[model samples]
Target: MTKRRGERPPVPEALPAPVVDAHTHLDACGARTPEQVREVVDRAVEAGVDRVITVADDLDAARWAAEAATWDDRVFAAVALHPTRTSTFGEVEQAELARLAGQPRVVAIGETGLDYYWDYAPRSAQHEAFRWHIDLAKRVGKPLMIHDRDAHDDILAVLDAEGAPDTVVFHCFSGDLPFARACVERGFVLSFAGTTTFRNARALREAARWVPEDHVLVETDAPFLTPHPYRGRPNEPYCANYTLRDMATLRETDLGELATKITRNAERVFGLRDAAKS
Candidate 1:
């Protein structure tokens, strides 16, 4: 098959309760300007995805994320040099990220961790950057949102070695049951993206089911990982409903109840209690 392609999927029905996109890339999703960001967020709100944590993958993205958070009360930010871009990490980038980390709306230091899947950056450079981001998260007293791809073992090793922040989230959690258990034991939150809805992602579904309600979160990882039935389509924050609904089905929980629970989890992890209330 040539495979289907098109614009972002249509927004699903509003969730029974509001939830958060724990990790996403607004800039990459083409929401670069304030108006564009609001347009996207407005649609997300219509789908009951009331808030989001827009994450950065590089220095420029870090800047954009920080500013984007300020663009809307519903949007917060996570700043970091992604694993693939860690090769360019240096004093200048470090200082900028540090500055952005302290911004009022920047809630976490991340989308950072090991990614052995893409060899864009050497393992050594990724390791160094990951450790630095871990420390940065600690210094800022914010959660660390990790992006662990095919480097689960090393990601865990680094977290152990550097000691983790009080709050850590494995964004787009791709781990199987064992790894999920390990993360749960360590009290690290696992944010599931649309991939969990894939029919072939049986292990991921099992892991999601095994996760304690308190440790589970839902995200779209927007502009990527659109949920099943729309797997090849472009993703957006509004599509978070699809993933969360699928998650509810997989976990055998009430959709509204699960939405409320994940919303609480995101609030706790991102320190968004005030935002959640508003």
Candidate 2:
């Protein structure tokens, strides 16, 4: 694991057009209070990442995420008990998540797919929690944000079995081209993270290149997958510009054009109305 060491990468030049850090963790990024949230967001805005969706990984995070969304118009929220944290899942947890998922600014039910890598929670518990989140997304009329790690097959199987929500976003998409194709065929959206910019992530880069514009989005997944050249350093929403630039180069498209498409896609999927301007 890359320990948090060294300085964070300097903010890259602002995007030609604004984009959203489709997935991030404001709490992990040290933005708990309203003022802290605003500071983080202002940095992102300067880098042309105008909005962010701060995703929750547990009950406390879910509450903070919901409250954080209320602090700034550009900040949104996705509430769910992360799959690894589902070992104690129960009725009270379900009711609270259901309630948080309904908040107007809580736009998705997510960061809640399967993770075979950590095996932190029993597979059964993860599966059960994933299914519940899927159902919650459907009920709330919001998108489902997934965190798939070495469980692509099982993730697909569960989504298939449960009947996925109308809108689904694979946050920090880690699959290869074939998996990307499958997800695209299912009308699911892939939110690429800084991982795509790594030198060893050739397959991920290929998937990024092949995925259709409308079926893709960008994120920082900050405080974790900081873009290449800055790997192992703390990340913030502003770092999304680095990932966007990397994707644009690989896709052979203009940065602004890709930014526009991704911005539009985030707005459309999140049901935002001029979010950057609002």
- Please estimate how well model 2 matches the true structure, expressed as its whole-model Cα lDDT: 0.92
Q: Estimate, for each residue in 187-235, the C-alpha lDDT of model 2 and write its tens digit.
A: 9999999999998999999999999999989999988899987888999
lDDT of 1 at 80: 94
- Per-residue accuracy of model 1 over 32-124 as CA lDDT, tens digit each: 999999999999999999999999998999998988887788899999999999887899999999999988789899889999888999999
- In candidate 2, stretches whose alpha carbon ends up further than 4 angstroms from where it belongs are 1-4, 274-278
Cα displacement (Å) at residue 156, model 2:
0.5
Badly placed stretches (over 4 Å) of model 1 are: 1-4, 274-278
